[model samples]
Structures are given as structure tokens and as C-alpha cells.
Target: MIELLVNLIVSVMAAATPLLLAATGELIVEKVAVLNLGVEGMMLMGAIAGFAVAHETGQLWLALLAAIAAGMTLSFLFAVLTLTLQANQTATGLALTIFGRGFSALVGAGYVGIAAPTLPKIHLPVLSDLPFFGATLFSYDPLIYLALILLAATAYFLTRTHAGLILRAVGDQHDAAHVLGYRVIRIRYLAVLFGGAMAGLAGAYMSLSYTPLWAQDMIAGRGWVALALVTFAAWRPFWLLIGAWLFGGIMYLSLYVQGLGVPVPSAMLSALPYVGTVVVLVLISRDHRRIRLHRPAMLGRPFQATN
Candidate 1:
């Protein structure tokens, strides 16, 4: 029983890593009042790019870099359309996701079913040798740790730093921020790029670390889940972690239950995570006041500088 429990905990953490990474980035983007819904597309692009690079080059770091670059490239395009040309954020983001899905499918056609090297786990000397705690906490790959560290840094930057305050101000009142000499568009561009990079990293984690293979549409709505996660977290970093874990556990439960020979249809089990997402969204949506209080004032709204 203990062993089974330990394995479940590890699986949950691994499953949660990508969501946490992607949501962390989106949180930053929304904090600056820019809504880029291309996260799914970005993650798909990253997955293919990372898998291709890893399969050909055999370098884990290079694969990760490729994923980040792919995500950023898509995001840069998004910034140009939404920020510079003042396109509709929602439509552009949806289009980006579609493009990412089709493009990644084309790029990954030849690499299907090909296995690639997975990320190596970093086992600390004494700590990793400890009891159950060591396996649960110390036996994760670098990306997992990076996700946690990134979240911590983001939390600090958002709540404790002057720049965080500036970001919040920009999100709350872009016109006033521009009047105060803050380059509203530029700040949002940076935030969007950062969000893209993180999304890409999340994709890389899925390919290079999670499954370690190339598969079309393997992101499987995780991008959308990550978007929902930001709202579910109420745009708060700490709560984001909890939400990620909750969803992660829900995602992995299907597999664990199947392994235990539970009497349930496989298809229904696979839908558990998404179903949980909808249910959670419904519950959270009930509190309109809470969402209004925490949601970025300028979210999904286009910004223009009158100069």
C-alpha cells in the first residue's frame, strides 16, 4: 500500500509540472492585461520542436531550447497581431492554436512513434537516499524543480517588487500607466514573450520528460487546462500550485484506477481531467465578485497608445 501510494504521488507531481509551468507564464501575461489564448498551440509547437531536436541531435538541453524558441516565435506573432495591429485577442489566439496544431502535425509526421531520450532525474546524495520523503521530493527531473522555482520567483515578483506593482498598475489602468511614461505596449510584449517561453518549456516537459516521444496533439488540451487554471487560481500564484496539483491528481487517477482493474470504461476515465476542469470552472464561476476582484481589469482588451 505504501509503495503504491508513493508511486501515485510521484505520478501526480509529474502530471502537474506542465500545467504549473504553462499557468505560471499565463499568469504573468494576464497580470500585464494581455490575454494570449494560443497556449495550446504554443505547447504543441514546443512538443514537436523539442521532440524533433532531441530525436535528431540527442541533446536534451537543445531539445528544451528548441521548444522554448518555437513557443516564443508563435507568441511574437501574437504580439504583433494583438498589440501592434490591434487585432482581436480572442480570435487571434484561437487562430494561433489552430495553426500550431496543424503545423505541428505536419512537422511531426515523420517522427511518429519514435522514442527520444527523457530528462534525467537529479538524485541528491543523502537526501535522495532518505525514506519516502526522498522519493517524493528529491527524485524529480530538473524541469519539475524549475517549475517550482519559477512559481516562487513569480510570486515574489508580483507581490513584493516595484516592477510587480508597475505590472499590476499596467493591467489595472493602461491609459494612466501610459500617461505616467510607462511603455504599456512594450511591457505587455515582454510579458507575452515570457508566457510563450514558459508554455514552450511546458511542452518540452511533456515530450522530453513526460512521454519522451513524438505524438501529434499530445498536449491534449493541457494548454486549455492551463488557461482555466489561471482563472481557477483566481490569478494568485499560491493557489495556482494547489489547483495544478488537484488537476494533476485528477488526470493521473484515471490511469491508476485502470491499473487497479477498476470496473470503468477507459474512455470515460480519460475524460476525467477535462470533466474536472469544467466542474471546477462552474464552481468558481459562481463567485462573480471574487473573479471580478482578482481578474485583470484590462484582460482580453486591446491597448493603444494615444501618445
Candidate 2:
């Protein structure tokens, strides 16, 4: 039983990695009051690009880099449309998601059934070879640790840094930020690109680490879940980690239970994460004031500088 429990814990952490990374990125993006809904799209593009590059070049790092570039490229398009052209953020984000889905599918056609090299685990000397706890906690790919570091960095940046203060000020009141001579558009552009890069890294993890292969629509709505996670976390980085792990535990549990021959429907198991997302959103939405307090004041609104 203890071994089984250990295995479950490890699986849950692995499952949560991608969501955690994506949510961290979105937290930064929304911190600057720019809502980029192309996370799913960016992730898909990253998955395909990472898989293709890794498959052909046998270089995992290059594959990950390709994924980041793919994600940033899509995000740049989003920035241009919304920040420069003042397009509707919602419509453009949705369209970008659709475009990513189709584009990734077309790009991944030849790579179907191709198996790329899996990401290597960093086996520390004494820590990795210890008993159950060591294997459970220390045996994951590098990206897992990177996610935790990212969470810490994000929390510190938002709470303890001057630049973070500037970002929050810009998000809370872009016009006020503009009045203070801060470049609101440029800040938001950087935030969006960062968000996209994180999302892409998450996608690359799916292909090069999680499943280690590519398939059509392989991101499988993880992007949307990450988006919902931002609300579940109430826009805080620490809470985002909790929400992501909770959802990840639930997702992994569903699969574990199915494997136990509980006679549960596979469809129901698959729906667990989405159902959890709804429940979380509903619970958080019940307190309108709390939502108002943490939410960026200028989110989803376009900014323009007037001379």
C-alpha cells in the first residue's frame, strides 16, 4: 500500500507539471492586464515543433528551444493584433487557438507514429537512490523542478520586486501607468511573449517528456484548464501551484481508479479534470468581492497612448 501510494504521488506530480508551467506564465501575462487565450494553440504548436525537431535532430534541448520559438511566434502574432491593431482580445485568442490546432495537425502529419527520445532524469548521487521518498520526489525530469522554481520566482517577483510593482500598477491601471510615463503596451507585449514561451515549454514537455511522442490535438485542453487555473488561484502564483496539483491529483486518480477495475466509465474518468475546473470556478465566483480584489483591473481591455 505504501509503495502504491508513493507511485500515485509521483504520477500526480508528473501530470501536474505542464499545467503548473502554463498557469505560471498566464499569471505573468494577466499581471500585466493582457489576456492571451492562445495557450492551447501555443502548446499544440510547441508539441509538434518539439517532436519534429527532436525526432530529426536527436537533440532534446534544441527541440525544447523550437517549442519556445513556436510559442513566441504565435504570441507575437497575438500581441500585434491586440496591442497594435486593438483587436478584440477574446475573439483573437479563440481564433488563434483554432489556428494552432489545425496548423499543428498539418505540421505533425508526417511525424505520426514517430517516437522521439525521452527527456533524461537528473539522477543525483545519494538523493535519487534512497528509498520510496527519494524515488517519488527526486526522480522526475528537470522540467518538474523548473516548474517549482518558476512558482517561487513568480511569487517573489510579484510581491518583493520594484519591476513587479510597476507591472501590477500597469495591470491595475494602464491609464495611470501611462500618465506616469511607463510604456504600458511594451510591458504587456513582453508579458504575453513570456506567457507564450512558458506555454510552449509546457507543450514540449508533453511531447518530449510526458508522452514522448506527437499526435493530433495532443495538448487535449490542458491549455483551457491552465487558463481556468488562473481564476482558481485567484491570480496568485502560490495558489496556482495548489490548484494545479489538486487537479493533477484528480486526473491521475481517475486513471488509477480505472486501472483498478472499478467498472467506472472511461469517459467519466476523462471528464474529471474539466469537472473539477467547473467546480473550482463556481466556488470562487460565489464571492464576487474576493474575485474583484485580486483580479487585474485592466484585464481584457485594450490600451492606446494619446499624444
Candidate 3:
């Protein structure tokens, strides 16, 4: 029983890590009042880039870096259009996603069906040998720990630092922030780029650690789930962790049940996580006050600096 429980926890954490990473990046972007709907596309690009690099070179670090670069490259385009040229954020972001999808598919065509090495798990000498705690807590790959560390750092940055306050200020009132010499466009650019890096890292995690192979649209709808996760978290980092795990468990539940010889249809089981996502969003939407209070005021709004 204990072994079974530990395995479940490990699986759920693996499932949750990518969602947590992607959502955390989106949360940062939204905090700066910039909404990039291209997260799905970014993740897809990262996945293919990471998979291709690892398959060719067999260097994990290079693959991860490649993933981040691919994501940032796409986001740089997003920044130029929306932040610099005053394009509509929503439309530009949608276009970015579409472009990422087609681009990744085209690039990944040659790499399909190829397998790559997975991330190495950490094995502490004595600690990792411990029966329950070792496997449950200390045995995960580095990215899992990095995700948690990043979340903690983000929470601290947003709530306990001067720069964080400035970021919130920009999101709340960009013009006012501009008047105060905060450089609203610059700060937002950094936020968007950081979001892209994180999304890329998340995509790498999916390909290198989760499945270790390339597949068309293997990200499925995880990018969308991460978006909904931000709202489910009410833009709070701590809640984002909770929500990621919840969704992760839901995602893994179908496989677990099927493995146990449950009679549920595979299609329905596959739909469980998305169904849970819709249900959670509907429930959360009913609470108008919470969302209004927590949502960034300048979110999805274009910023124009006046001299």
C-alpha cells in the first residue's frame, strides 16, 4: 500500500511539473498586465526543439537551452508586435500560437518516432535509500525541484520585494507607472520573455522527462490548462501550486483507473482532465468578487507611452 501510494504521488508530481512551470510564467506575464495567449504554441515549439536537440546531440543541457531559446524567439516576435507596434494583444497572441503550431510541426516531421534520454533522477546516498520519504520526495528529477523553487521565488518576488511592487504597479496602471519613470514597456517586455523561457522549460520537461519522445501536439491541451490554472489560482502563486497538482491528479487518474482494469471508456477517461478544467472554471467564474479583486487591472490592455 505504501509503495503504491508513493508511486501515485511521484506520477502526479511529474504530471504537475510542466503545468506548474507554464502557469507560473503566465502568471508573471499577466502580473505585468500583458496577456500572451501563445503559451500553447511556445510549449509546442520548445518540445520539438528540446526533443530534436537531445535526440541529435544527446546532451540534456543543450536540449533544454534550445527549448528556452525557441520559446524566447517566438515571444520576442510577440513582444515586437504587441508591445512595440501597438498591435492588439489578443490577436497577436493568437497569431503567435498558430505560427508556433505550424512551425513546430514542420520542424518536427523528421524527428517523429525517435526516442530521447530522460532526465536523470537525483539519488542521495543514504537519504535516497530511505523507504517511503526517499522515493516520494527526494527522488524526482531536478526540474521538479526547480519548479517548486521558482514558485517560491515568484511568490516572494511578487509580495515581498520592491521590484515586485513596481511590477504590480505597472500592471495596475501602466500610464501611472510610466509617469513615475518605471519604463512600463521595458518591464513588460522582460516579463513576457521570462514567461516564454518558463514555457519553453515546461515544454522541455514534457518531452525529455515525461515521455522522452517527439509526437505531434503531444502537449495536447496542457497549454490551455495552464492558462485556466492561472485563473483558477486567482493569480496567486501559492494557489497555482495547489491548482497544478489538482489538475495533474485528474490527468493521471484516467491512466491509473484504466490500469486497474476499470470499465470506463478510454475516450471518457482521456477527457476527464479537460472536463475537470471546465468544471473548475465554471465554478470559479461564479465568484465575481474574488476574480475582480485579484485580477490585474491592465491585463490584456495595450500600453502606449506618451511623451
- C-alpha RMSD by candidate, in order: 1.1, 1.0, 1.1
Worst 10 residues of 3 by lDDT: 130-139
Work out the TM-score per prediction.
0.98, 0.98, 0.97
Q: Report the C-alpha displacement of residue 232, candidate 1, in angstroms.
A: 0.3
Quote the lDDT for 69 in model 3: 95
Query: What TM-score quantifies how close candidate 2 is to the native fold?
Result: 0.98
Off by over 4 Å in 2: none
Tens-digit lDDT string for candidate 3 (1-307):
8778888889899999999999999999999999999999999999999999998899999999999999999999999999999899889888978998899899999988978878999787787888757856668898998999999999999999999999999999998999999999999999999999999999999999998888989899899899999999999999999999999999989889877778788898899999999999999989999999999998999988778
Error of model 3, residue 28, in angstroms: 0.3
Clashes of 1: 0
Residue 16 lDDT in candidate 2:
96
Report the C-alpha lDDT of model 2 over 65-121, residue by residue, as the tens digit: 999999999999999999999999999899889999999999999999989988899
- Of the candidates numbered 2 and 3, which has the greater lDDT value? 3
Q: Which regions in candidate 3 have their CA more than 4 angstroms from the true location?
A: none
Q: Cα lDDT of model 2 overall?
A: 0.92
> By the lDDT metric, which is better: model 1 or model 3?
1
Candidate ordering by lDDT (highest first): 1, 3, 2
